[model samples]
Target: MSASPGQNLFRQPRAVFAVAFACVVSFMGIGLVDPILPALATNLNATPSQVSLLFTSYLLVTAVAMLFTGWIASRIGAKATLITGLAFIVVFAALAGLSGSIDGIVGFRAGWGLGNAMFIATSLAVIVASATGGFAGAIVLYEAALGLGIAAGPLIGGLLGDISWRGPFFGVAVLMAIALLATVVLVEPLPKPAVPTPLSAPIKALRHRSLLTMGVTALLYNWGFFTMLGYAPYPMELDATQLGFVFFAWGLLLAFFSITGAPWLQRKFGTAPSLYGALSLFAVLILIIGLFTGNRWTVIVCVIASGVVAGINNTLTTQAVMLVSPVERPVASAAYGFVRFIGGGLAPYAAGKMVDHWNMHVPFVVGAVAVLIGVAVLTTGHRPLAAADAAMAAGDRHTDPDEVAGEVADEFGGAPDAIDFEKELDHR
Candidate 1:
């Protein structure tokens, strides 16, 4: 008898939910703090730039933590790391809620960021490990959940922040507890044990030219993306519900496309062209957003339009980055995550400074420039990644982990200390 068509998806539904809730919880903590920045500044008797550090503090720790969490995931196992991270998050969030002073919140925010680093880094690796056909479907699912989490953050945060600045953090802490329990009980352990690769391997991979470019691309995209998100509502004087609607549209659009639009585009244009097109359109969308500010209908339309491009851009960029270093995907992803978060970390400071010194639109202009820079990098450094992916794909036998490992080792050349081909080969 034939198996059900969607069996693979259900195979690890519980694990998926655990990770998805983690995504939602971590992001809720972030968004909850965001809308209240102005309030936080007033309450704490701080400058806007100082209040913005709440974001910078969290993202900075998360970025630094990502550098090692991927290595830790390999050693401890993805599932275990995920549970630990969520527990840390739950504890830290509750502490953050109880903070009596700005310095207290900053300290707890850094701790929260550290927990985020653990959660996000392991979450991606776990998804990839759980999937049947590598990360193809898993990426889409991850992105969809990411969109939902990001989309919900503003509305939920706004509501809670209005009631009390501390309310959102407490509410998110409650969510984190539930997530922690789900992560502990619901997710199945990996069938195969996680193979430990040496720490030096990831360090070496980070030095690769292709991976460096990918990191740069990620940083630029995030700089632009977060700048837009971090400061958009404030300049326009949007209420919490309106901000929620914007995020809702953003999530809904990405969910629709990730499930549908991306596949069709990939089928038609192939990865490279689709990638370039998505990046190009992303740049244009940034311009459109800057141009159409203050009109609710236009803002909603532009925000939603940007989601399709973002969904496609993320999936394709991840694929492109992975293609260049198939064996080192986890490490590469961590590096990319680090770069993206670094950019994200600085965004609030940069955008807030801009809004404080110049005007709100200044940040959007700067964001547009950042997106354009990413497009330029992607367009310029097109060859190495493409050539590498083609070389590996030629020898890789689809769905065969052994063949995939062999192909990757051969393409990247055998580096025992760097790759530990034996470890990868055995995992197959």
Candidate 2:
């Protein structure tokens, strides 16, 4: 028997693998600082809350800059954009390593964030444009990078941070430079969008009801996601190496589920129901973490369990947004990114302040509540979301992840009725 699309996960072209490898290294930056958070505070004479600015500066810049990544990529071409982004990361990460003050590191991290935003937004389009197996397979590949990076980041950071707080920063610079080289050598040049993406396009995409609804939902979801990442570590009181192990365990489960559990759950439950369940469960986990902030073991277990929820949500929402939005995929991506990253950026900063002014429980409670609010926000788009489900079920489309389609084939899983995005680009 021929292999199912699900079984054909690893059989990708070199370009896909190259970009995916770069993706893994790029995403590692997200969690690279986790194990080092405490170390920075102690070494730099900063408070835990001030150290939290690292996430804030990075994500806030990413949020704002990602809005224009597509526009920039369209003008410069994808390969150049990816290389530029990688170059920015390499420079800023090294600068951050050399910085003396918390404020200096925070500012350099903002530069790193801009690079990350450009790289991520462009890479997703490139991966989908080149991937094999199927649309679903491509997204799984992308998310796999995210999961692997998340899993490895803290462990590497922890190991490096043990030597010095500056270690992870230097490590990121080296790894990113290698990724830049691989991308240059291995990936073929991708065709730019025929018409340049206007600066106003992504913002205008928000006018679509489905896109807006999903964006708001993601905004709320990220509030919970980043809060866990930014503030949860403070309560654990583990050293850098121990913290790395805990998050490594968490990332392992996250990666495993991002590949296996999410697709299976979406298959059995459909996107909306699976998303509802995952968000609900994650909210409960955050609540548990909040209620037992003093119990290190309890907090650790809940954080690990959250990986499953994060994985499921990451895959499903990605497909759902692609499927439901009426706008072009790149536009939808940029707009969605703009909303979600803003929330992702601010949540941790807020969490730090909340902890200072209130109790540890306060931040977790807010995170849990934010997730619940996301679930509610998602409900408003039920009809369109249901339409997307119908579109997926129309063919043998239930198995794959994302499709790099345009306006004509808005649904993922590559239904027969949909137009091929690459072919469309070729014709144009």
Tell me the TM-score of each prediction against the true structure: 0.85, 0.92
User: Per-residue CA lDDT of candidate 2, range 338-387, in tens?
Assistant: 89989989998899899899988999999999999999998887766666
Q: How accurate is candidate 2 locally (lDDT)?
A: 0.83
List clash counts for every candidate, in order: 0, 2
Off by over 4 Å in 2: 1-7, 398-428
Candidate lDDT (C-alpha), each: 0.69, 0.83
Query: Which RMSD values do the candidates have, in order?
Result: 3.8, 4.0
Runs of candidate 1 with Cα error greater than 4 angstroms are 1-13, 41-46, 100-103, 132-134, 191-195, 288-301, 384-428
- How well does candidate 2 score on lDDT at residue 188? 91
Best by TM-score: 2
Please provide, for model 1 over 1-428, each residue's C-alpha lDDT reduced to its tens digit, 9 standing for 90 to 100.
Answer: 01125546435566777777777777666556655666676777877667777788888899888888877777777788888888777788888778877888888888988888888877776776665444556666666667667666766777777777787778788888898888888788764345665565556666555566777777888887777666665545565555666666776676667656776776566656777787678767766666776565665676668878877776667655665554555676777778778888887789888878986567777887887788777765566545544553453413332344345445554334555545664664
Candidate 2 residue 168 C-alpha distance from true site, Å: 0.5
